[model samples]
Target: MSSHSHHTIRQAILDRIQTGEWALGELIPGEAMLADEYGCARTTINRALQGLANDGVVIRKRKGGTRVCDMPVRQAKFNIPVVREQVEALGSVYRHQVTRRVEKAPPTAVQKRLGLAPGTKSLQLDTVHLADDRPFAFETRWVNTRAVPAILDAPLDEISANEWLVQTVPFSSGDVVFCAVNAGKDVAEALGAREGAAVFVIDRTTSLAGEFITTMQLYYREGYQLHSQL
Candidate 1:
């Protein structure tokens, strides 16, 4: 409102979101309404709101409008996507490598998260997300065969489920959590880091059309950081 300060607008929007004054999935007021409330011009409100959406603090749709999220986890707020686009943002080449793939029974922990009964069939995919051939993330993903049964027979070495999902699937809801974990032998090898090193782990569960789709764990090297403005 006062010369379009990022700090001012971000705090105001965040206060509303945290206070539950704006519930998740509820459309935000239009720019005109916000301008009236904030005592600012429509341009200022537009700039403020646009910055919030870009920072993953809000979801903006052309006709659907902006809405608050159900699970407002800050780490889960942004979609990091593949490292290729990230590195390319700084003018670097993106690279990828598939380490392994196996169709096997889902682990007990994975089964519980997917709400699957014990001994459900699943496919495990291990991959290294790289930037300019340097390890960026160690990703171990489990695809629920019941959700996408054909994954069992597909050549996972050629394409990642993350890539495929962007094209074919639409998620209804998601559960995401982030934590710090020690890089064990498997994780070290995948991320090209030393064993026992500290890494950031992001676990994501995606649902499509109200049904469980897949659950994935993404591990990033120590230096990796999630950044945002507003």
Candidate 2:
């Protein structure tokens, strides 16, 4: 079989789980059985099941076999496209500016959200994304220096923190939240909009193997829409 066969097996298994064909807490067919069904090696089935286990979609035990999780911690698979790609996809020029970068104690709310210790120092970045010379989105991010020390030397002025992090850091799990908020003074000024204008916000926190990587909040100008597919 091709090296990529495991991905196909993974998707097939995920579809079965998601569609309820494999009920929660139900033991799936053994790896050997699945291999025979899929006409692939048992190792391919093992790899697929292991990936599902890592994503919290399945539980695997040496003697208990593999089963659908009773309460699956389903992770939303959102592909965070780079802001530059988003702008360029809209047939506009993409530009980004790093307005601020500092190392300081994060706010109490930020600390609580990220489960950080009090007085913990983090690298904070404020950036504005533009499309066709107009404000597209404003971003504020806090990065755990201990988790990603390379950011300390990376040039933020020439490259946006979002793009840089996407390229440099690898994450295994994350949480995403969406909301609507009124633009405050800082966000309003950065987006060239009046105060209290409605804006769409996307907040994301990412972790690498259970260690915090970064938390970012992206505030898009009015009329922005987020799209995703199952």
Candidate 3:
């Protein structure tokens, strides 16, 4: 397609790979050539190719160029879910409130994970997501204001940061971690569960290009199951 966006170009490349036009482990076209063919900027082609590389679809070398993966890896894909939609999808009314919002120095672990200098102030938000007037999840997050300065002007009191970030940021790649944890006091209080109760936790970090954006820990109400397709 002419003048196609990066996402469209990404899909087109995938289609070619699916139909065996691009053989496994074979080199693909360079960014300049793809840009000329698609009538889009070279940066668009680069972004599309970066997405494929993130998904393990292709390998790219700064000097050697790009190639289709000989053996594609199978991984479960999970898009960041909007909490309001998630609640409504479950046939429950969704309501949320920000319990805390402050700009403060994050923990050493958080700083290291984000590759930030020590004592960097990040926008920290603590919130409770409700379903049908009951607690659903508790979220603690750190926003990298350097990457997302708009978050400072966002009305956190009126909208959940979870929803706000999804609407405001365009992240290129992310990592998700799921685990089971015994609830601590703050999390138990937020979720209205007994202390020490088992809860599902999701830790997610997202970035655009090379800059880290945010990292968050979500503690779901006891017995919550994540249903996803592989």
Candidate 4:
């Protein structure tokens, strides 16, 4: 219990629910209580609960606390969000700048993630999306040119790569991860957040016919809230 990680705690919680230790629609232990039982910090417990809620396994209310969803959604889908569209929907002027773009060898991690051979070239881009001229999100992307060479011809400065890709490129499969990260200097500057401020990050990769298209990470500005329907 002393060295338990949040992922371990998450599985433990799920196991309990599956075993009927907590009945469906039952209120689960509060964070503080779970923290004590797991010999971990409350924040660790919090992360576990947050993951559960996002997966529709639980419901969280400001005053009612947390309870298991009576009928959990076993499967959920998240479409790629277009930055420009998101801003426009908020009734703000949408704009973006291609801060950096290069076609070079990707980092080893990105290379492996995209299953590229060593020294394979990738189109890397750093972009800052704006809402009414205020920074909204920072996008960092690595594209495998072999999968989608047309990206090289797109004018990213005029229209964000996100908008371009979503409109043109179609994907048959993809994966995504959502996490919170403390802003580093580059991300902080792009998003107008203080260094070390908590930022919401989305990491995604798409593939068409087993050929990976791209791997990208989007870091949103402070106070960005993601809404989803389950």
Local distance difference test values of all predictions, in order: 0.70, 0.83, 0.82, 0.83
lDDT of 1 at 22: 69
RMSD of each: 13.2, 11.2, 9.9, 16.1
TM-score, one value per model = 0.62, 0.67, 0.68, 0.67
User: In candidate 4, which residue pairs clash?
Assistant: none
Local accuracy of candidate 3 as per-residue lDDT tens digits, 126-214: 99999999999999999998777778988887888988776545555678999999999999999999999999999999765466889
Q: What is the lDDT of candidate 4?
A: 0.83
Q: Cα lDDT of model 1 overall?
A: 0.70
Worst 10 residues of 1 by lDDT: 69-78
In the range 1-230, model 4's lDDT, one tens digit per residue, is 48888889987886665445675567988999999998999999999988877656678898888987654122225668899988998999999999999999998999998999999999999999999999999999999887667778888888899887765554546799999999999999999999999999999987643567799999999899998765
Once fitted onto the true fold, the runs of candidate 2 whose alpha carbons sit more than 4 angstroms away are 1-76
**Worst lDDT 10-window in candidate 4:** 69-78
Q: How many pairs of residues collide in each model?
A: 0, 0, 0, 0
Per-residue error for 72 in candidate 1, Å, reads: 16
Question: Which candidate ranks first by lDDT, i.e. highest?
Answer: 4
lDDT of 1 by residue, 149-223 (tens): 656655555666666554334344688888999999999988889999999998889864344778998898888
Error of 1 at 108 (Å): 0.7
lDDT of 3: 0.82
Looking at model 2, residue 166 earns an lDDT score of 68
